[model samples]
Target: MTHSSTAPTDLPVMLPATYRGPDALGYCRWLAAMPVWALPVMAGLVLIWPTLVHAQTVYSTEKIMGIMAKWLPLLITKGFSMNVVISFFTMLLGTIAGLLLGVGRVSDNRYIRGFSWLVVQLFRNSPWLVLLFIVMLTLPFEIRVAGTYFSVPDWMKAVFGLSLPIMANIAEIVRGAIQSVPSAQWEAAESLAFTRRQILWQIILPQCFKRMIPPWMNWYAIMTMATPLVSLLGVTELVTLSRQAMEAEGNNPSLLVPFYGFALIIFFAYCYPIARLTMRLEKKFAVKG
Candidate 1:
């Protein structure tokens, strides 16, 4: 009878006894138990790395990673920066429009209330991409006034497109926040010789500010994510610039993962902290019954 040097022939012989990795069957079982999206996502990166390294075409002295590193910062400067600008302006415009629409929703005048509700429902239900196309195509690129031409930039159109949905959403947020204030507050303010406008501006709206904030931040994050859609409009955002970089590099198939991967990383980096902060604020501001 022969003694085995390794009882576990399937496992790594060099690994220390305490840290020997899982055997193939155990690893397969573990993978099977993971969520549906988890395996594919893990596999996409893991499977692609070695394949690209072996197959990557060396057009310049630079390797795939170095070329990617050079462009990553460029992506930030030339591309993702525009995305941030669009998101900021979109949020600002939407907040203002939404405030007016929300006020209208609560207006005593039936006409104002009906108009606000109609605008909200229409924009809220429409697809964002459709809105973007509508706005971009319908608006003139430039208009002349007094022999001077002012052009509407594609990024501005993106802002308008994004703002429509945001405005509709924020209007709902405002309406809900305003209504969440007790009717007693309104009645009490009315009894104190306050006009309807005074009751809203002085008493109800002040209380609603905290309630509106978490959702406003949430929507801002969402609008940031959606800014990538503007790339379709040829608005020079991250994805569009990434494609341009790839083309300049002779469109190596291998660069797809690194370029898009870095973009994914940057977008994730920007949005994830906002999401965490959103959760914390929600918990912090949650009202007790």
Candidate 2:
């Protein structure tokens, strides 16, 4: 029977191999583990690859670099200063006001609490542009200091306007963080014959610092970004000067993307780290119920 079945011994047949080398198996595993969105991103890159290549070939990369080099210093020197000064003063005033309001919110007197709540609500709910315009239009442009004339700059008005909403938001953050401490903490402090003010200052606030830090940094980053709103008040901030620089570039519509992209990169470079730090802090000091 075996001899009869061996008639086709010389015929060719294909057999599948079951074994793969370590490298092949590893590559397959890595591909399987990749994020679901990776394929779409790769596909998008493939689609845009030709356009990028074409643009690079058609345009002089050196010319674009030259333009960026010319304007970047001016933007940094003139535009950056205005943003920094305004943001600094705004944060300073806002922090002071926010601390006061937060303390008032927790005061024994109902009037103090109501007044603080009113202020927070009034400022927080209003649009920043509206506040900026109101301050710019309504506030006196000049003040006499010790019989000397001093004119208030638009940037100063912008600072005051920006501070109002920040004050309100920070007040809420302060209030919430203070309130998050257990009632047992307050009771324990009271049992030890500690005054309410003493307890709040020495015990509660120290503990609240960890909780407050992340939100404070988050808001600071937001306020820094919002400094561009000062441009509306005629303060020459980063955005305003960016426009001026663009104008100097012969108003070339094609340059819009690059100029704006440069600004975006600058802002991202500054703000992204702060954002990442905030997230890291939030994770570190996350209060378990």
Candidate 3:
């Protein structure tokens, strides 16, 4: 018997199918719940494994300890004495400049806005290295402060050069962070008869700072790492010292690895804790929000 067969087209599938089975979902959730440190540790192990395999012999414990003792003190001193100091001051001045510039950027007055825009555009568009060179070499000699015989010092020149570009970037970050605060919060402050300054100081800036800390810390870390650039102007920071030490150990092929590696470890040691703290603060703030 012949029967006519018809294609069944009762219902169309709506949602795209994905292969997220229960076990897979559970595994993903478990991975997501793991501490952040696990990933970095795993990555480090993966990176170092090849190096370890290729090495002819592992470093002796005593040799490693000797290397650490010789290098660690210098690293600590240089990082704290110069890198940290420069970074802190740079961040502080940058924050202040950025705040003012950002406010000027949003000002209703066209002249103020245009001037700030020009400053931001010029600084932002310029290379930091070139600006650093100009400030250190050219600016003091060429442009004296009006009615003052005292010219800016090379150190101050370096600081200003490094800081201004950072300030321009930070200005945009500050502006965005400020704008991100709820409009309702601003309105509520106004309803309470608060002055602009009072509202900004009391209500807005606190929340903005909380949001800004991570990026601020990141910027500071970068600046701290860049302390070596100061050596170009004869500032003699850690990297300079490392270079000197490397030169002192002339013709020793193995010394370069330990010298530079030790210095790198120092930088990472200084930076990692701050980065972790920033992450914690960000997480806390996220939870609060």
Candidate 4:
């Protein structure tokens, strides 16, 4: 205590208030630079682990092969055609409905706007499964358009049921995108003496379309996956074919796993490339904030 030395009271000295250790600094940099491989690895593990753990010990090679042979032919013939037709019709109807609702959402007319809001609220708030059931099983039985009576074949009804909800969702997306375009753009179109239709189709719609493509692509992919739901309504689509194959397997429950799994794999294989393309389009069209 007696030998202790003290600096002058007024002297300034610099000392670090805090230190970021090298390990901490390196960790932040590592995280920033990390590759995106981890997520895919995790997803693959999650998808594969259940199958591996639950696979039956008494695997019949003939049963597996026979199921594959029977399913593959039908899948290539009827299943493929039905999927393509359903997807096309759904996309067509959804696009038209979305465009009209989107325009109505931004309309100056109160009636049009209110009606659009009501449609969106009614459809969007309901569960898609419920909507499908109503359209397929209940609507035709309950509601008649005229003395002529409107009826849809079960296949067409399935398409309509699946598509209507999707269209409602898409309408909101399109409306939002259109509204997001600068107000100045609308004013410019007006100043140029463009009619409302001209302004919308020429200036706003095109720009909105670029913005809309990503979401539309994603929705299309979802719709493609959802084609299986058509089977519930007696549409002899892919899932229906697979179900029939499973029944043909008779008492062997083990075949159920492979049959369904193979069907799922087949659908995934068809849709995966489309999903990848959509992702690429999303990246390409992403607007800078």
Estimate TM-scores for all models.
Answer: 0.80, 0.76, 0.68, 0.74
**lDDT tens digits, residue span 117-139, model 2:** 99999998699889888988998
> Candidate 3 — which residues are off by over 4 angstroms?
1-72, 78-80, 139-154, 190-198
What lDDT does candidate 2 reach at residue 163?
Answer: 94
State which candidate has the highest lDDT. Answer: 1
For lDDT, candidate 2 versus 3, the one ahead is 2
Error of 4 at 123 (Å): 1.5
Model 3, span 101-210: residue lDDT tens = 87777666899889988988888658777887877777654444686577555556668778988798777767777888988998999999998778877888788887
**lDDT per residue as tens, model 4, 52-131:** 54466354555455656767788757775687688888888988997899789888899999999889888865877778
Deviation (Å) of 152 in candidate 2: 2.2
lDDT of each: 0.80, 0.75, 0.67, 0.70
Global CA lDDT of candidate 3, please?
0.67
Model 4 deviation from native, Cα RMSD in Å: 12.1
Candidate 4 collision pairs: none
Q: Residue by residue across 125-146, what tens digits does model 1's lDDT show?
A: 6999999999999988987899
